[model samples]
Target chain A: MTTSSIASPDVDAEHEQNKTPVSFLGPFCTYSHQATLLAFPDTSKWVLEPTSTIKEVFDRVQSGAAPYGVVPFENSTHGVVTFTLDGLADRAGEYPDICVCGEIYLDVHHFLLGRRPPSSSPESEQRSSGRGGEENPKGVPLASLSHIRRVYSHPQAFGQTARFQAKYLQPLGIEFIDVSSTSRAAQLAAADPKGESAAIASELAGREAGLDVLARWVEDREDNTTRFFVIRRKETTEGGYPPPEEEGKRYKSLVSFTVPHRQPGALANVLDCFRRRELNLTSINSLPSLVAPFQYLFFVEFEGGREDDHEGRISGVLEDLEKVAERWRWLGSWRRKR
Target chain B: MTTSSIASPDVDAEHEQNKTPVSFLGPFCTYSHQATLLAFPDTSKWVLEPTSTIKEVFDRVQSGAAPYGVVPFENSTHGVVTFTLDGLADRAGEYPDICVCGEIYLDVHHFLLGRRPPSSSPESEQRSSGRGGEENPKGVPLASLSHIRRVYSHPQAFGQTARFQAKYLQPLGIEFIDVSSTSRAAQLAAADPKGESAAIASELAGREAGLDVLARWVEDREDNTTRFFVIRRKETTEGGYPPPEEEGKRYKSLVSFTVPHRQPGALANVLDCFRRRELNLTSINSLPSLVAPFQYLFFVEFEGGREDDHEGRISGVLEDLEKVAERWRWLGSWRRKR
Candidate 1:
């Protein structure tokens, strides 16, 4: 898992010599993999490192096992991934040299992948036996969700498809088997050749694992999506994203801070720093303070980049925010996903 | 599952007749049950309803199956319970008649419950065969965490005890079995009878389920606590708590609002409404908008009851807030949990 910067401006040389490896929580071919590919897509060139857990990805970044790490931050249907946020907060304090350098929004569509569709219909029988090479030549047949004895998936995937599960599977008394990752679910289904198990995973994962797609886009919400963050060492040349000078690009800055306890309107005072500067916050989440009750640590993402002037409003307001906050840390400024 | 309310003011009648049934996510003997008992402690008189899931608890409240619903909202180690938050938001939109009337904070202590200590040491041998009457006349022996084959508990319980699991169970290659609730885990371990399985659950749950406490306070953090909300139909006379007129009492209001998308500082404008009146925000969490990208629904809790007037500031500020927000809903204002 050795990694080196692809700093050469020449694209060919950059691809040839510095095959920068990026690590993500894995067994391979999960949504995290898709997000990594979407963010840096020269498959043959860039090395991909898959770790066992989200914390491991951060650990690799901190230990220099890999220069960059990708981890899911939030899902449209599931809200924020608290562990990811907590891990970031903790590692920031422990390893001051690591930060979120960029972010990617990955639109997720889960497919029920299995050895064969549950139904015994002629169409499904033919498709199950058919080589159905590239492109799944024959249209796949629908499976009887009720016949699914077991479902294997990451908890979040099950959460995203909760409505579907309740409507189609719960009444039939299907057993849900929780796995560490969606890809692990796919692997489990593939290994269970008896076709009694199915996994809710990306289409890419099914293909990579040589499994059939019993159902497509099974998520309850039409727009199931997940946001990912790319974390890298502070000294890296390419901060996991394009520079602001890249044409037609806009960026957002993430900031973490804590306010003194027993201070009335303390949060309002800090928020005013951004409001007065005309910075619109995209998201805000708070965690209770471990040291004191009724106190919190806030993580905020706003519309302007830390380096961007926004007509000189960004830097000055950030300076004032530092003064108002009991403790503050600028996470990073990266291209905002449109 | 028949339920009837005990509305009398007589303490004995309140205990014997009113038996106000309270609902919580179930398999029984979990932290939710402990919290419910802590909130309403006449166990013999008050009916206790245990729903199958957190969402079921909300559904029961919305459908009038139960007048009072108790659900965990957040944990100090795990942060906000997203599903609980989502259920609150979803039910609010579907059934505007329901509201959060009060809150309870319960200190959580997890114990490892098993049939017997996973060892044959002299102390354990004496207890393994010893009826060890009443309170176990002799102290039980310690178990080698490595010998345990399976650990069962809710995900949050496992998360709160990650360090212990990593240091002990992981090295021993123990299997983690996720259950609906901690009490369910205790029940499963009790049913096993072979001493190979242990459960991470409350001490009270262990006692109720007739399981031996192999280890006490097994959670990594001693200060682990969970905050719960009491939901009831809006027509309830008491609103689930003593009125603000009670001596030495304070109240907090929970509000949800949506600001105009694409409006610069729209949230700031709405927040300003609270700030101008000197209202202090206790916490704020945002959920992504389903209608548009980057838009959010903000849930904010502040330090004032809806009925209280800060020299007429409450009404004036709320009126202005309604004007600024595209949509607003006052969830409720009840006694602040100390």
Candidate 2:
């Protein structure tokens, strides 16, 4: 497979392209796996490696076993997946060859599933019957948020539903339960016949567990989506391939840093460099630097490839910031997501 | 409430000297409520304002409805509670009124609750026989992880148990379920019998539902503990609160800011001011600015009261950082957790 096949017909016609094998964490059923499949669909054409953790996937991609890997970057509800960020930060220096090539957006859905509803009491049966199917004989209706007493879902699902849980369930005396996955939520509801319990999972999971649908799109926002990154190992091009000249081509660079503890205006001084250089930052987030309990590690993704701009301009800014930063790493840049 | 009557002599005597009320998000039985109760036992005298959400608790303290509030800052398993961070960031300008006074650590325990084990099943009989003379049959010991198809707990609890679930249950095809609270996990498990499902919750919650304890401390780490913050809505006095200052007194200041993207060393420049002035930063976290999809708001807590240090030094640092920041706020300063 070549870049020509994947690129848009209207773009530079002679641009050279290469297909790289990609890997991700998966059993073929997870959202991460789905992202991987979506990012690179021709499994047979490009080597597809699936690992068990985000670190393993990164290692594989960095080691060249697979040229690229896909992993979840962050979820709107769950914040950042620290493991992925940490792995990238830890390997940023050694794997100067790696860069985030693209990103994908996935909509998350939580469902409730179970084998059967708990056996109903005589009173429950009469009450449900009178409600004309609006309520389960022993189970609660999927739409009746108030009747729910317990809810089960994966941590990611729970995060996505955080606002909903706070608004409808927490106040209504409902209990939000956490499970390993949405499928597990379905299984638990299926195994029980209780009317007071429900699970947040996927519809497919509900089918697998023989559970009733309790709710759909229970997230705080209707536009619920998770962003994933596609990272590829750095490669040095041979002399035969021609370089393309195009203004539209773009790359994203990532960096991590820790600032001096006693510095009052450390972060501000750092931002000034960007303002003066006219560089556009796409996104930035800081997580607790796992190595130091109270310290922080910032992950920043910005527009423009490092090589596209003046080297002195970037170095000059970095030097000024270094006085206050305990450490810093410039993750390589890559073409914007295709 | 008089400070003299509420101070505890058993622990640190100094912490008792300047005791104050703490509010939290709750309806009396929630985890945050319990955590607050444990951290501050003198409920009769110290005000315990239970609000509907963590934001409410923060607001109540900021508005002076209560002097301080105890809120769940983060979980060992789940990274950050975005809502809490967002709330704190939203009120960054009030830094002079609120500061982190102390931190609390608590262990989490999970349990299973259900109806009396049915005597007809061999598994039920085995569980009953193991009870050692108890009339009620205890929960049946799981034959294997594979026998468990579904599990439930609160979202935070589920995140903490991820390693355990992946190790023992994922291969066996166990699914996780999310619920509002552990207590509700017990209620749902109690209501269901035929399903091969269980709830991950506190033993106290199980006992309340008349369910047998199937497991305890089911998290990956036995030392699993959640840290809570005691934030006061008052500025610290200058000159270190005068002589005869209570022992173990530590001060903290909080701030928020946004900076230009992609400029190298932007953060370093901000830190330079602090390093030149000699202020120690305690903690920092960044949350997505709710108003903008890509922008972020950073929450930083550091040592030294704003008043203790002359306004010139602090304001000078702020002025330098302000050049690169879209907006910034000073939350306030107070003694560290006593």
Candidate 3:
């Protein structure tokens, strides 16, 4: 937001000298990076920083190193990113000020990315020369899929493209290489001297790495997407949580809690609170409580924002949870992106 | 069960000539292979066969190519294995007879595996000759982790050992090579001639590959365990499904279903059926329905099995589900393995 320098003295004064920073989990060309860019498009107004891990993304915002941070929360194909959920739950008390302010829903696309064989290369020479239907952004004909020996991508990427991998690569006994990120995979694939290696990564990453897209839309499902949380440190004051930036936008609230494992119907009771209010729970996920084997820390998202709690329904659910749950936190509401 | 060939003329006759085939997901040394061995300890009575993928494991069992198949159902750390879940849900119609008969819980452990530096190598000479605190199975000291330029592993292995990786390997900016399986990672690590590569795999895999265990139990959590399902084709007769071989045991039932997305409390109502009966839900997970964007297919595990439904509680729940859910499948019960 372009706040008036005269009206906003404290916040604008710091940003007048240096740009406002936004942190994301990245090497570069990763989905988190893309989400960050999408969240803050004004490069002149914002400085984008990439952190090594999801923890660092939270830490940056928590430590006030950055005002905003973006991290992947879930994917349509791969259900949840536990690290992100766990970080949010664990730091609920100590980092109470940091909360998700918005969300980014990105349509994820994985491509078979690799270096194109040079014209003089034998693999190119051995091609059937029948590149009729295929065309890539680089305008170079892709080498035959048979020429590729190994594939590289993050584990989630490998999982997302299971159907494609089984159909095209399994019979050939091609080795699948997993990396930390899709961008890293692209970088590794590009470093292959023989052009025999491929990466399942974003089209942007492949182009940046100077790799060719061997195959497009390689994910198991066409509707593959990742949801990202745009977290910012709320200006907590004696007034409590700040008012919503957009008053009328429909929002989704995320709350994390834990219940005693020995108690039967405890989780169901907590859920029943939402059901009774017709809150419309969108997602429910759990991570190990870490204290015991069967214990879990649960996260659930519902349709209404704190501001939208006109009937005091969200507060009522929290009140019900007080009795059913051991610990809980209202991890701020965000406008729905999808 | 060792049935006399003379008593059982039909089933035991073919098995007498040839051992029953037990299929698993493997390249050897995989957790699935280990589980298969655990499930069928009588080696003479069973022939263990390794399949390339989980789908193949199901295919073999459905085709009767293998009488029993062992597939990983879930992990404490990673939650559900969606591929395994989806396979069960989809095959409910065509492979109605196949159902989960048993479960195996394997404690998962990851090791930092690599080749030791040769005694004559320069790196070994530079070791200060002060190897005291550490010793490996091969009786050779591990070269410093600094010597490892790249680490190979399945993505889940990388995820499981993220704490260790972040503390040590991340600082070195060591490249991660992801493979199809942990066993494959061990194979790749062992092939490193310079001993400059490491793999995060099982101790069995590392030892079988002739690699030294640099570190033991590198998994981030102590309670890391994978749950496997022993699936077998039921012998359906004109009368009905047969009775359980063992009568009174604590059993867990897995059921798969989908509720209409348009309905607000569709999922909560389905869960209410179990809650009202005090049937504790051990786990709940969702996967994209593939039909549309927001639609999901859900899998839930509860405390009771078919025969344990003495009061017809489970059947009553199923009857209730038929009204709430679009489709449902009672995917058999298995004795719980902690």
The share of true interface contacts that also appear in candidate 3 amounts to 0.29
Model 2 compared with the native: what TM-score?
A: 0.62
Please write out the lDDT profile of model 3 over residues A1-338, one tens digit for every residue: 22121111244555644677778988767877777766676565766778877878887888888888888987887667766875776632446677888888888988888755554455433221223243432222245577778888887787778778877887778877667799888888889888889888887777777776677777877788888898888753311212335344777999988876756577777888888888887877776666665567788888988867789988888888888888887888977766
Ranked by TM-score from best down, the candidates are 1, 3, 2
| Order of models, best DockQ first | 1, 3, 2
Model 2: per-residue lDDT, tens digit, B174-267?
6555565666666777776664667777655565566655544566455455667767655633222222444445566777876554455555
Say which docking band candidate 3 falls in: acceptable
In angstroms, the error of model 3 at A144 is 4.2
TM-score of every model versus the real structure:
0.83, 0.62, 0.81
| Tens digit per residue, CA lDDT, model 3, B1-338 | 22121111245455655677778888778777777766676554766778767778888888888878899977776556756876786622446667887888888888888865455455433221223243332222245577888888876677677778877788888877667789888889989888889989887788677787677778878788888898887652211112245345777888888887756677778888888888888877776666666567788788888867788888888898888888888788877765
Residue-pair clashes, model 3: 2
Write out fnat for all predictions, comma-separated. Answer: 0.40, 0.42, 0.29
lDDT of 2: 0.58
Candidates 1 and 2 compared: the better one by lDDT is: 1
Clashing pairs in 3: A177-B178, A178-B178
